[model samples]
Target: MDNHDLKEDPRLPYRATSRMEVVDVPTIAFLAATGEGDPNTSPLYADVVEALYASSYGVRAVAIEELGRKHTVAPLEGRWWADDLRVFSARDKDAWHWQMMIAQPPWVTVDVVTAGIERARSRRDLAEGGRVTFTTVTEGLAVQTLHVGPYDAEGPTIARMHDEFMPQHGYRPRGAHHEIYLSDARRTAPERLRTILRQPVEQSEPQS
Candidate 1:
């Protein structure tokens, strides 16, 4: 989803949010990250995906610009996709910890998913029509949200985040907020939509 489309979406709870996370990325992944939908519905680009899995490195805390994405969203079945995906591994003096997942290296966002997926198929080439774009992200503080609900109900949670979570948690949005969608809307139940909204944050007044 692009910026304008994202803003017009009704599911979006807030303008945007950021977070604190240690993306424990392994080898870069072909289609390293995808939000287009129906992963199983699409052809598996095994070879390229495998290679990306084999060549990733240590984890790092990089800012992510997350946006909500929903296709044919019903009352309960909406999904979010982080667009304009960017990454930049760096060092930080602060201390925080969280789970990490294998991700494409921050600098190599390209149209490799279609190319790799095409190369993997034996007979059918479905082709990669939608791929999460990855690129370089500058370091800084940001804001985010921790949403819990059906994809359709995320708006209220986003409101909670924008109003209560950020302010009480000592955060102010520095840029476009990010969302770490931990659940698959296609598979997960509507009542059990699990998502992590990550926003950049720092000591508002020197952490006194």
Candidate 2:
């Protein structure tokens, strides 16, 4: 069986550069869980991530054994926001809201994913698994750039995009901050970690 990987998938713009560029992101389905708190320190965040992976692996098993399909688990992605945008710049993670996700192929139906979650639940007490749901998002137009180094050091790049590039290009932010984790934090060095920073945008109206 062929191994399907998101990194190799042309449909996903997983490859990015330090240069900012505009891209149209198509609607994609995901197994996702939403919560609020610091990803670095929140217990809920850890549980959510564990639940996502467990469920995704479970889904892969069902797909290969029962549906005759096999694929590598996709990268972890997130959409983050806060009641006050300043909280992000201030590094006040406790005030953040986020949705963490793992992509799923079209063939993985909701029922199949549910079964996967059920399998995970049978083995461990992942109450967060119950929060996982099959969902989709359409981020039509967006600007993206590659960010390297520790996740905490992204402020400058993000400020440039939102404060300088967007205004200069007549675009305005439209959605929550999105990030695709391209490097595994568990095995990769923090300074070498790769992440794709994406933000949905819309054309700004001309002032009268």
Candidate 3:
């Protein structure tokens, strides 16, 4: 059986150059959990991460054993926002609200996800297990870039994208900020971490 991998799929906008690029994003399914607070200090964040990966791997096992198919689990991704956008620029981690997720293959269905949850539950108790749910996100027109450094350093890059690039190009930010973690933070050095930062946008209307 052929292995399905999201990074290698041309239809998906998985590749991003260091320079910002605008692209139209289609609807994509994800196993997601939403929470608030700093990921480094929040217990909820840790629990959600554990639950997401457990469920994802469980689903992969089921696919291989029962359906005769295999797939590489996609990397972690996030949708971030807050009551005040300034909080992000100021690095106020406590005020952040985020949905942490992992992209699932197109063939994965509700039943498959449920079975995967069951499999994870059987192996170990996941406190946030119930919070993990299947969701589809349609970001539409978006601008993205590859950020290679510590997550904290992304502030300047994001500022440029939102305050300069978007406005200069006649685009307006429309949705929550997004990110794809291409490198495992636990094992990768902070300076070498690869994160894809994306923001949904819409064309600005002409002046009256």
Assess every candidate by TM-score: 0.39, 0.96, 0.97
lDDT of 1 at 31: 26
Model 2: per-residue Cα lDDT over 1-208, one tens digit each? 8888867878877789999999998889899999998899989999999999999999999988889998899999999998766566566888889999999987899888988988888988896988999999889899999999999988888888888898999999887989999999999999999999999999999989
Kindly list the per-residue Cα lDDT of model 1 for residues 1-208, writing each as its tens digit: 4222222344333233234332221222222333233322323333223322322211111112221322221121111223322211111102212112233323323433333333334333324322322333332544444466664455555555555666776654444444445566668887876666654445445464
Q: Which candidate, 1 or 3, has the higher lDDT?
A: 3
Question: Sort by TM-score, best first: what order?
Answer: 3, 2, 1
Q: Pick the candidate with the highest lDDT.
A: 3
When sorted by lDDT, best at the front, the candidate numbers are: 3, 2, 1
lDDT score, candidate 2: 0.90
Clash-forming residue pairs, model 3 = none
| lDDT, candidates in the order shown | 0.36, 0.90, 0.92
In candidate 2, list every pair of residues with a backbone clash.
none
Candidate 3 or 2, higher TM-score? 3
By TM-score, is 1 or 3 better? 3
Report the Cα lDDT for residue 134, model 2: 91
| Runs with alpha carbons beyond 4 Å of true place in candidate 2 | none
Native-to-model Cα distance after best TM-score fit, residue 30 in candidate 3, in Å = 0.6
RMSD of each: 16.2, 1.1, 0.9
